[model samples]
Target: MISKLELLDNLKEDTGQLWGKMSAQHMVEHLIYAVRTGNGKLNIGCFNPPDKWPTLKRFLLSSRPFPREFINPIIGENLFPLQYENLEEAKKILEEEIKDYYRYFEENRDALLLNPTFGELNGSEWEAFHEKHFTHHFSQFGLL
Candidate 1:
């Protein structure tokens, strides 16, 4: 349950350091992309093959934390280009996307979400995934 308030509170002038190339702004923008994908705003297919989906989904939903400094297939190498002009703009957009994420589940409870790594998931699963994801990145920036 990593809320926007917590994220905003922890986002200082100097948030991230040395783990990866993404600045705090870049991390926010990256999160926005992920949220968009979860809410069905961005329709990207799963990178993992169908045979591996069950295992991937299980791991994603498990309590195990995401590994640090792992390459994200969706964001790295400018696969999905960043759109924000600055950190403030990225944060604003991410906040809006967070709101939309809740709204999306409220509207479509039975919808199957296709994550680029985790394949199909329901609304509740998507929320859990997001919580884990946000926690991971927030920690990456030493916010947690």
Candidate 2:
């Protein structure tokens, strides 16, 4: 698993992509939202389809790579509204969010975080999801 610090190191303003619509900055901001969600700072409700498709959630949570161009229902196609003015600003905020996210997990190791799609996730699960999620987008931007 690629650590967040390593991912941040590889990420650059000029990083080009082999897939997806997000610029590097957009991707960083997108990750910020995800980290925040995992830290319990953001709650967008749940997309609880586990009852309808029991194996789906387990599959997603498993050690499987996320498909390229998979539309994140929470973020959507257009991308979330920009939280910062430019790439540098976004990167700065993202770094801060990363710190906060780990801090949150440290303080509340047993907390149950709600995922929009996968329902509730514990710290370890969230860490795994984050690793996969970041790896997917980083690879998307050719950062991996």
Best by TM-score: 1
Tens digit per residue, CA lDDT, model 1, 1-144: 445346666685477654777778778888888899888899889888889988987888889998887888866655345677777888878888888988888899899988888888899888878888888878778777
Model 2, TM vs. native: 0.87
All models: lDDT?
0.80, 0.78
What lDDT does candidate 1 reach at residue 98? Answer: 84
Mind giving the per-residue lDDT tens digits that candidate 2 earns over 1-144?
225556667667788878988888888888888888987789998766647434655776787899998888876778766778888788778778878888988999889888777777888878877888888887888766
Worst-scoring 10-residue span by lDDT in model 2: 48-57
RMSD of 2: 2.1
Model 1: lDDT equals: 0.80
Those runs of model 1 whose alpha carbons end farther than 4 Å from true positions after fitting are 1-5, 77-82
